[model samples]
Target: MVTAAFPYRLYLVIAAEACAGRDLLAVAEAAVRGGVDLVQLREKQVDEPTFLARAERLAERLSCYSVPLLINDNLRVARRVGAAGLHVGNHDLPPTQVRAQWPGVGLLGYSLEYTAQLHTPEAEAADYLGISPVFRTPTKTDTVTEWGLAGVRAIRAATPKPLVAIGNIHAGNAGPVLQAGADCLAVVSAICQAPDPERAAAVLRNQIDLYC
Candidate 1:
């Protein structure tokens, strides 16, 4: 069970490719300046060495802002970089194993692809739960469920763990997602691919503050 409320209000899930040719570190730095409280480095298609290098760079950059960086499904890189946490999906490493392997990890997140996952031990072990693909989006094509607004409410009702709502989330839809019971908003293209990442992040941050 979560011992404290999840501290982050705006979570950014970023990958180098998603930045639309912009410098990943620069984009992340700007986003943090605009009020991003948490960040996750997701380098899915890269090799371990490349992923490790990127994580190392990102960890260093985020350290300056005091924003915790969560490495997505890469335990070796996470451990090597001394990341603030690790986030795993159902097909990735199990949260129970992650806990056993990295007992000192500060934050642990698990993606909820199905409501039934909430009843499992992994969900119980996570520091917070990610309600993925709250709406269908091209970024995540393999997800099993599109946990729309109703799904967010259902998950909130079932678990007290902090919920980070992801997928197709932007300023326009952020308020309703929060009202539906999400504790934080996680975004990708909305900020990464924007013409000005700082302004984009600030806009989303405002939505979170205004609605959540």
Candidate 2:
């Protein structure tokens, strides 16, 4: 059975482009050192071999700390590399399909941006929900739905499932996201593209803690 792996409030979504020429392992290590609990590798552009290699490296990096490494949009790679979980967007494989096909791979997360999409049977098949575009975020150009704080609050009240608020989230605005009932906050550029990913993560972690 799928279970929740998102116990930590500060979620880091890291992509190679966001690393700014730094090694992905280095970036992940720094972020973890600064208190990032869960990580999702969003490297959808690479070939299969490269993707598996990176996922393996990241999984090895986080093993000692016990931080789960989630592979984005590639359940095959996730299982091959022994990734802790999988995260899929709205356009990708629906959560129900993933669950039915895999049986018990790991924790499955689906993107939920609209209140209309809340608490659906597909959502129930997964372990957690990602409430994306919580604000206007350029970090993800493909995102069409921009769910503001009001939407986050609405989804929080509407769904019994665990909520992960993501998109353009930073240290300054994390409080309100948490106040709106987000169980965790997923950040991309806020921490991944910062000058010091470790320091950025620390500040963001403090912001999340302050809200609690």
Candidate 3:
């Protein structure tokens, strides 16, 4: 039987600039209180030490709730801080190599930027596939093709791995995103930029639960 890696329904991707102009730790804590399943720290503008420091602090808080912390493109930091997992894009590190390098990092997530990757050995070994750019968004400048709802449906039909639909996902259209067959809905600006992080998280979680 295949084991699920990303078992959470609400995936929150937070960046320092995106956290409602507030402390990311505070925003994440409130988001957890509102029911975030997992959290990924995707800082685009920070040095190694700064990133490591932030990860350590966030790991401490998220651990209390038993929520997994995933580092974006940084396996060293994740392991250094005793993070639960790491999220890697296709361009970062090959999943096969990562698996060989760190066999113990339990939750391995692979970003699916194109349809051709669905059947690769990497996808087969991955615990979850992040279907990104489900809609056009400003959060990521290096985005792949806009997956749209149709793309989600196509990828869902093509893969057995747990799907984490990302990019521009919000409470407004979260139901459809889930219905399109994503096991989890990952958002950046939606909750991170909300006026009230807890409420934003709650609303998104509600949508996920409702659709399920």
Best by TM-score: 1
What TM-score goes with each of the models?
Answer: 0.97, 0.94, 0.95
lDDT of each residue in 63-119, candidate 3, tens digit only: 999999999988889889988888888778778877888899878898888899998
The local lDDT score (0 to 100) that residue 47 gets in candidate 1 is: 97
User: Which consecutive 10 residues in model 1 have the weakest lDDT in total?
Assistant: 1-10
Q: In candidate 3, what residue range of length 10 has the lowest lDDT sum?
A: 1-10
**What is the TM-score (0 to 1) of candidate 3?**
0.95
The collision pairs in model 2 are: none
Candidate 2 lDDT over 1-212, as tens digits, reads 11255567888998788888888888888999998999999887889888888888889989989998888998888888888778988888888888877787667888975567775777888788998888878778777788888888788778778888898899889998899889888998888788999999999999888876
Query: Candidate 1 clashing pairs?
Result: none
Under the 3 Å rule for N, CA and C atoms, how many clashes does model 3 have?
Answer: 0
Best by lDDT: 1
Candidate 1 segments exceeding 4 Å error:
1-4
